[model samples]
Target: MDLSSLRFAHRFDQVSGSAIREIFKIIARPGMISFAGGNPSLAALPDEKVSELSVQVLRDHGKQLLQYGATEGYPPFLESLKQYVETAVGFRPDAVLPVTGSTQAMDLLCKALIDPGDTILVENPSFLGNLQCMKLYQANLVPVASDDDGMDPADLEEKIKAYHPKMVYTIPTFQNPSGRTLSLARREKVAALAAEYGVVIAEDDPYRDLRYRGEMLPSIKSFDREGWVVFLGSFSKIISPGLRVGYLAGREEIIRKCTVGKQSTDVHTANLTQAIVDQFIRQNLLPDHIRTICADYGEKLARMLGHLEDLAGLVTFTRPEGGLFVWAELPEGLNALELLKKAIDQGVAYVPGTHFFVDGGHENTLRLNFSNSTDDQIDRGMSVLKTIFREAK
Candidate 1:
């Protein structure tokens, strides 16, 4: 009767813990000033056109919209996505394949490459979801140290020379939790190192298009001369998170492998949603919508950053040019999770910095989302955070 002795695979044992989910319980309290989620600015939605496009598409192709579609994903969605990737991010069209969301693409990639004990190189403080799935495969999770310039290239090279991970997973553009972008020189180093070591890189970049400031950098997929990188993107940030649509772009052969693995996962993403989304994009609504979204997020991010100046001297947080997070590190003696208890008691909530670390050392750090808050909420939140820091002092 002992289930532990029944020999369940290690992946099952590894998949259960989640940091954000536990923190979410506190944010649900009435009057809480939540800085925890990475959700986008709702004002960024092209609300006017989404309804218009949805109505028109359904009226134009009702039957097709409802029917099952390709295992690789809906044709127009893929085609529109290919055009977007090539023109906006410099990826080749044949390389991208759609998935339920970037999360599923992450799962698919891990399934495709990892065998128990195989190494998967990750940023020391990396995406929680990616960390969760990699552990599911029971792969040797090696933490690659990172800073504001993103993952350290020399450290990455050293890891490669030593461990030879099956793949190096990175959130290169406006990285989650840290809101850090990989520097151009550092990026070139990563690409060269991957190619030189025959290591595969999984470039998860859902936040590239959400830039509220600065110039664009080409995606890692654009620099894959040796077919050494697999890039993941999602509409969840730019569009509706509820839609759950995302894609993977890489060498065609590798995508084909991911596609076979994807089949056993969801079979294919929903055709009806694909048809609706495809119609909106191919027919020209997505661009206008994204522009509106960027503008909304830009303003909100500005508000948060401007107010965050209050935390200066006592703390430091990332000022991202794009993406949906702001990472802050508290004073040496404070634990961010412990501070969250005080903050939540004061009606403010945030995820602890330790949740994102692979080896778990950044106890005083925390992530904030500027996208979902109003100006008033941001100002009030910062005032509260400042009070907390001052009190801790």
Candidate 2:
């Protein structure tokens, strides 16, 4: 038999590769001003600092770092991380488990909790990557309603009543693609709901430190008294993404389950990276680094919002206090997927927002990332997008 005739797993029957990854390939061409990926700017990556940390960590613990490490975390990182979680993240974790990235945190959670056909409630326009992760686990992803304040407590309660979901996955702070944060009241309510309903809440908050404006809101995990909420955190947005160091913090039993699940998946995160991040926390380098990043990204966000203001009649977009993405909706009867062809032709690129939807069909919406682009690039890219959207209208 030909290899093409081979049968594949049924889990992928409804799942497809990420649409954003395809856009990344197209945007790789020379002179492409991409607003597609949630990437940090080159200037924010701190190559020099990372180089210094890498050398120091290796010299300090050369043998241990090169060797296999524990599934839980590197010992030094484990200690520093627990303190960082308590002081910075505002929660006292019963346990913490380091993973490859926050994305892996989602996978491990799904592996620990989800079985095929078990329902998982989600925000309608949630993170694309996590949505796909749930689908692969064969969980029925049901979308709850959301508005300016984030996921509605009323609708979320109703969904829980109707579906009796096993888990509720949320990107509570500076949510990806949409760039909306859950309000303080809703954060408390979500934690309460999880405790009452006996459902696990995955609070994916990778961009919590990327705030550009407004006061910081407490994490949902902070209000989680019963230990139903698990906080998934990442250094990808603040530190270098290439480092791929993220962690999971939750109740002891739940974290133990995830730690076991993680053992089979990559064994453990790279010890070298964990040690380097450990130094960052111990030396308290993150505060100053995050401040510099917030300043640069805040300016870019304002510039992008200004351009969007000029196209106010032509488009409506979210004004996020912080986060890399700005979600925009074109006029009705215009399709962003179709407009993307025109954008790529003009050396500009953005992700069509329809892909972020669970069931798909918001054809007028698109997501733009301002963090990776310079002011000149934003002006030029938004100009191209403006002309294309206007012509389409």
Candidate 3:
């Protein structure tokens, strides 16, 4: 009766970051100020509208919302989402499929398109979950280098040529843990590379709408005329992360494949959430709500920027126009994780840059989340950070 035959897949054997689990444990502690989560700001969660929308959904679409939803997700909400994508993002209506969250949309794409040992080209400092998903599927993740301006298009193209990758994964808008927005030229370069190389580009854009300082850049999906990119958009940033509503858009053939894959994942996303999101959109409440979030976060980001301006030489960081985070690289020879541990002891927490990379990561790098901090807290945190920078140096 040996269970050795139940040995797990090779993909499951690799070690994971202890930092993630440690952060999870400390998150719920009282009086803890966390910059660890990449959550949309509390300013963004449309509570009043959500409550109103939920009531509307129940009053008008109660029975349908509570039932087992379609595997492709709610039709009315999907249609609304499709229109939003088409009108705002320059997509065709037939290309998008709603899912439980942007993460699930990524999962669906991975499951359908990634066979074991397939190559995945990823940003050097990349999203942890995307790396985790690729790892679970035994994807040979090739890391593409990047710079302050954001992902290096030439590096990505080189990787594509070398690996003939299964997919190129990116968080182009205010990239996670980096807050680095890809320039328009770079976006076009990468898009061209994807089209030329016959590789799929998976663009996860949850924070695309969260900008406080920058001009809008067209999405990579906007250049996806050849169906080379699968764009993932989420309501988590605009509505509520807890609701977990998101969608994926690509060529209908690829979307159809993902839909079939999703059918076996959770059957479908929760009907109640979709109904609420749909109701909110129909009532024309989303624009005002988004404006509120943008305004609040804009002030917060400004405060952080003001505080950090003096420490410019001692430390370096991205000043993202829009998005939740500002990525900082400590002066040469410092370790961000060590700085984080010291900062935590002094009543602050942030994610180290290691968690963001798919390959080589800078030890001196760290990410600060401005959306969650109060203006007073921003000052205090920066004061502590200045002390840490001096000590670490």
Candidate 4:
């Protein structure tokens, strides 16, 4: 028999590789100005600080870190992480499980809760990575309608009633791709709805600390009295994504299930990285670090938005207070997927927004990232994009 005749899992039949990752391959050429990934700025990664922390942790706990650790978490990280979650994240979790990254956190949650054909209510243009994760679990992803204030409560309730979904995944703050934050009222409403309908709310809030202009809002899990909301957090944006340290916080039972699931996943998040992040929390390093990141990213965001303002009538975009991305919709009949080819030719790139949608039809929309690029890159890249969009219009 030919090896090409092998059968793979049926769950992957409808799924494909990440569109953003595929775009990355195209944009890897020298001089490409990419606005595709939700990457932290290179300058913001705190390399010197991480190096110092890594040395201190290794010297102090060399043997312990090298040894296999528990699936639940690194014990010291668990202590500091819980306190950080309470103070910085504004939620007191019943339990917390440290994962390799928030991406793994999402996978663990899906593994724990979802069976094939289970329903998951998602924001229409949700995070593509997680959308792909849900699909890998063979989930029926139902889109809940959203506006500038983020996911609408009324529609969310209606979807919950109609679908009776096992989980309702939301970014809630500085949402991925869209950069729209959920309103405070809707946050409370979502928490209440989760409790009322017995549905799980996956509050994935990696960019909450990256705010530029607005007052901070409470996490959806803060209002979750019945422990229905699971807060997924990451240090990727504020710290370093290379470290791959993130956590899941929620009810003990839910966390326990994820812990068991994680055991078969990676055994545990790398203990060395966990210790470094634990020290970041314990030494109170995040506040000053986050402030530095905000100031720089805020300027980049402003510069990009200023460029977008030049096409006011021809393009409409979300004005996010914080986050890496700005979502834009070109005039109707203008396709962003087609525009991307022209953009790459001009040495610029952005992810088409249709890739973020569950059903994939919004061709006019595109997602731009400012955090990873320099001021000159934003000016030049946006200039290239502006010209392309204007000519297309």
**Alpha carbon deviation, residue 53, candidate 3 (Å):** 1.3
Per candidate, the number of residue pairs that clash is 1, 0, 6, 0
Off by over 4 Å in 3: 1-6, 15-17
Local error of candidate 4 at 351, Å? 0.2
Which RMSD values do the candidates have, in order?
2.0, 0.8, 1.9, 0.8
Better of 1 and 2 by lDDT: 2
- What is the C-alpha lDDT profile of model 2 across 55-155, one tens digit per residue? 99899899999999999999999999999999999888889999999999999999999999999999989898899999999999999999888999999
What Cα-based lDDT does every candidate model obtain? 0.83, 0.94, 0.82, 0.94
Write candidate 4's Cα lDDT for 1-393 as tens digits: 998999999999879875667798987889999898888888998999999998999999999999999998999999999999999988888999999999999999999999999999999899988999999999999999999999999999999999889999999987888989999999999999999999999999999999999799999999999999999999998899999999999999999999999989999999999999999999999999999999999999999999999999999999999989999999889999999999999999999999999999999999999999999999999999989998997
Give the lDDT ranking, best first: 4, 2, 1, 3
Error of 3 at 1 (Å): 9.1
Cα TM-score per model: 0.94, 0.99, 0.95, 0.99
Clashing residue pairs in candidate 1 are 44-293
- Regarding lDDT, does 2 or 3 come out ahead? 2
lDDT tens digits, residue span 1-393, model 1 = 767668776577756565677788778778877888887666665566667767877788777767766788877778887887777677775667778879999999988889999999998788898899899888889999898899999889889888989999999999988999999888888888888889999999999888878888987667778989888888888777777788888888889999999888888988766666676667766667777778878887888888777768988889999788888888887888888888888888878888888878789889888788888888898789888877987
Error of 2 at 81 (Å): 0.3
lDDT of 3 by residue, 258-280 (tens): 99999888999899998888776
